[model samples]
Target: MSLTEILSNFHISETTEEIYKNTIKASEIETPIGKLIAVADDNFLYILIKLKSPDKVINTFNILQKELSSSIVIGSTKIITQLENELTEYFSGKLKSFTIPMRCLGTDFRQQSWNQLKKIAYGETMSYGELAVKLGRNVNHARAVGSAAGANPIIILVPCHRLTAQNGHLGGFSCGIDVKTWLLQHESKFKNK
Candidate 1:
């Protein structure tokens, strides 16, 4: 179904002085990758995210749809939409990681890192040191690269959880390490499928 159709199914009512206040509709679509959450407001696509949220997953989509109904189409991807669905199910404790197409905006280097992050495959991880080397940079650049990873606007769909410290410690996450740990364990448990 279309995004509008999905959003129309929700009961939305709220007002925010924040920029997201002008939204029109929002929706969540399930995909092989994860749950794709999209917000459309004032003719603009405000936020599209993929992640697991026990309480906010469904609510966020409804809220966003009613907030940004007018704005620019920030980005679009059938893969992302599909991923959203998968993630929603997973977050609801029904599934695991996802495989889907996703799009993001950032600097050249940040974009590169984000793209590489997507390839990190579920249940596996790469130390910042290893990531720096894969990016063809000296291991010393690991910290800098880690910073870039943290700045990633799109979180889970980018799979930033696959990155960690050299000692296999969960480092930092833009969305919170608790979420990261959950994702890692979830993926690891169902990775082979």
Candidate 2:
């Protein structure tokens, strides 16, 4: 049977063979800003993408379906639930840092950049050059660091929104510049309270 057929059973087998199967559970949750589609596996939360309209959520799911060889089932796990709660608190301005478990998928260099991205405190912003220097990379490595930041898949949970241009201009965000501006403004408004 196909992986999709297996996932349609709605119960994941814990056997060794089943464990080797890359079964991804996905679900969509609404937020104040918009709807976010979360895709995760049994042990780790994978990618979370934001959309301005509910209609576009499926487009992302379709893309993931093609990109990942795993079974992209429409379901949620305990970890996904927890992350959703954390997102709720964050968007509501009650949480600063996320406490949920996440296993980031990226290269060592990109991972280093993402780790530094998380270190940026809430209500604060840093430039790409500053982030690169903090990671012990040369100042000119800022552009490369920016590339890694753009590649980050976890989005708001990792606080990629905290990164700005050296002159403090809002930088690029995969979710769009408006969303970036909103996230920065949202954090700044509640970070001091």
Best-fitting candidate, measured by TM-score? Answer: 2
Instruction: Please list the residue runs of candidate 2 whose C-alpha ends up more than 4 Å from where it truly belongs after superposition.
Output: 1-20, 52-69
State the lDDT of candidate 2 residue by residue for 27-123, as single tens digits: 7778766667687875777777674433334444444444554557778888788988888888889999888777676789988988888899998
**What is each predicted model's overall lDDT from 0 to 1?**
0.60, 0.75
Question: Could you tell me which residue pairs clash in candidate 2?
Answer: none
Question: Per-residue lDDT tens digits of candidate 1, residues 143-167?
Answer: 8779888766456656788899998
lDDT of 2: 0.75
Give candidate 1 regions above 4 Å deviation: 1-81, 89-100
Candidate 1 has its poorest 10 consecutive residues by lDDT at 65-74
